[model samples]
Target: MSWAAGEFSQEEDRYSEVLRRQWGSPTLRGIYRDAYGADYPEEADPFGFVTRTDLARITELVAVEPGELLADLGCGRGGPGLVVARERGAVLRGVDVVEAAVTEARELARELGGEAEFAVGSFEQTGLADHSCAAVMSVDAFWMVWDKPGSLAELGRILRPGGRFVFTTWEPSYLDHRELLTEAGFEVLVHEHTPDWLHRQLAVYRGILGHRRRLADEMGQTAAATLIAEARETRSVLATTPRVLIAASTPA
Candidate 1:
């Protein structure tokens, strides 16, 4: 989920630090692997909400072809993108600003034995060719971006005509969601707000963090507590918050 409306730099540090800590913990990794029914990403699902169920929905929504490309933005460790690639028989391209995440994603792609690539890039510039991707998905990463409008423009530039863009993220109650998307040359199709679902996932996340309290302590109590506290905060305001799945298409 999105950390906050304004946590671009702070979000980056938290993401990388948490991911690094989780990657180093075998017990926590095992828990996440079991959660996914034995197929874990190179690391855990940092977002904590994109379960296997969401994976299937996204795969079907994108409707990718065998030779098509799917670009995943803020694709930490390439979990969702890799799964979508495998499910749709589509090539995978993941971009993240974190070098560590990009490295893990590349390794995961190699380990999974697929034609996938990961790059260290920013939200406003992905370094991809124009009109090259057939579909794109960003999971729980867009809110951390400093330039949502520019990022949407970049997605429009890279996506082929009629290419679909799916984003699963959270939005504050105060924003006009459609204005930026429309301004970036997209036709917004569906925006499903599922705050109840998001709240349940947050509970699961808190349970996971509580279950691995010892591991969290080993990593550092401050980090673990910070994560759990954030989850609690989200739960408190989930009624007002909107956990969203936005599907839009590039103009033909």
Candidate 2:
């Protein structure tokens, strides 16, 4: 896909920098692995708080037939989507706004030897052909998009009729926007809080905060500072805000 010179909004540019810096940081990776425990797929190198149970639930919710196409929106590093697609025998198309993330995800896909592709794209503008995918998923990534309505419209545009839409997010709405989903041509199938998400996120944030000095040494000081700041800010609201897993489908 091609892009205009100024196509990316400022938010995308800033997130690109954050993902670029934190992409291959060993310190941060170790923290997440420890936080998530033994079931965590270390090779996949997930970028956020996702338990193995969460992945299995997502796979079940997606319910794609063998050889069908699954789109992973905001698929940072291609871990969660890769695992789900592999479990369901589905092909994978992963999209992210960060170029560095897309590059890393492509490399990971090559290493894992799966039918997967990654591209630099945003939630509001995936650049995917209309009705291209049988199922769509985003793991711990949807909350990053400030324009929820536009992104949902893009999701509706790309997914085929009757396609599944499964995502784990903790936005301010708590994934209870039934009206928004209806307007965007989706029927809400599942919406429930995942309390374990809070525990895992808190552990990860505390781990990051505790390892700031080591993270600074491994990744740059700038990246370490940003992570520390984010951990502090995010953890403050995590306990109060609800993390949710939501499943929806377009009308057949």
Candidate 3:
């Protein structure tokens, strides 16, 4: 599958730099661990759905088994993927466009004692083989794929027949976008909207800005300020943003 370089495709490097700094920060890691029991490598997404409860739900939803290959797209730092690997007893393979994220993911696997592999790659161009995986998932990372159609096609190509695909992501109009999946030929099994999850995530971001002002400032004055403003003005940015704990699978 090929994609014309669009907004997200153009911003790949920018996204990498932003996440590299933010996700690599020790302060943010400590906060995530203390507040969420994420005793793993993570680049905490103040705007993502990656709590223990959510990971647990995804683990069961994906129905991965021992020795199966569980490919994690946008696997940043390996926290979410590691949880699924350990819980489901599946071997994990993660890919991220950010080289730093891939590096951290490798270290994370060693530190956490999980069976996993990591590579620097992108969603639309993941370098895995056709029908190479038993299941594929992305925790709070699907929206980052700029070329939705192309990426979906790539995912479809990489997953074997009957493989499950699950993701926790946000969609402004969750129901209106089901056509994307249908067009990509996925059979939707679950498509539940999660408003409370968005609200809670926004609340967490707001609380972080309030309590970790210094840390936020250190992250980048402009970015932190903008994020804080967005948090405060969540009426549009997040207050009504619907997150989805959606799941789906390909035909056998």
Candidate 4:
């Protein structure tokens, strides 16, 4: 089903449900393994295809330090969170609305022996303590949220003084996405487009499509069909949504 079909009141519920169902399926796990490799290896970083480049950009803007507390909003499968936790030795906590994704991420954290925590909850209303985190990061999942302003404010609330917040969204040059950070209360720290960013994004989508085909051939038609369907749905949304990378600091 198209993302637009869901009502605002149920958007998180719907997204979490869809992703949970998808991730829980053994067929889908096989497809993910074949397509993205084993849970974003240290060198390979499977999420590299999805959000690695942007995550790098965001990290540079935020400058997280070792032993500091970091929060990852909309932490899909905890790939980006793992990266930061591993790289910075930060106490990382990843929160997502999807229960299955949270479970999967927690399991991956245990398996990888990374010092990271995963919680199933919405970004807007995570029960985290106020002024608790040193940095907050998200990757390509803000569009699914109903209240961007409220979410940003919540980010601000959770950050310690001088804390940084960073995330990547579809660039406006490529899609007609909305701006939600500034409206909430963040002062933008970096707001420049990368070279050939649109081309790079399109290439990643193409890569996903190609991987779906390859997996289908190796795993049989059912697995292939599901991956293809999910990829198509994601492509359709991204094709029309604006993309951007935003980093801001909570005012001290």
What TM-score goes with each of the models? 0.83, 0.90, 0.82, 0.72
Writing each residue's lDDT as its tens digit, candidate 1 over 10-129 gives 265565666556556555555555555532333335444565656666788887799799999888888789888888999999998878888888887877766799999876889899
lDDT of 2 by residue, 1-252 (tens): 001231211244444555777765787888888877876777667877777888888999998998999999989889889999999999999999878888888888888777998998888989899998899999877766778899998888899999989998764533446677888889999988864677777788899889988888877777677777667666656555667888999999
> So what's the TM-score on candidate 2?
0.90
Higher-TM-score candidate among 2 and 3?
2
Indicate the worst ten consecutive residues by lDDT in candidate 1: 1-10
Comparing 1 and 2 on lDDT, the stronger one: 2
TM-score of 1: 0.83
Top candidate when judged by lDDT against the true structure: 2
- Locate the minimum summed-lDDT window of 10 residues in model 2: 1-10
lDDT of 3 by residue, 28-132 (tens): 545555555442234323324467667767888889889999999988887788878888999999998878778888887887776899998888988999998
Ranking by TM-score: 2, 1, 3, 4
* Backbone clashes counted, model 4: 13
Candidate 3 pairs with clashing backbones: none
Worst 10 residues of 3 by lDDT: 1-10
Best model number under TM-score:
2
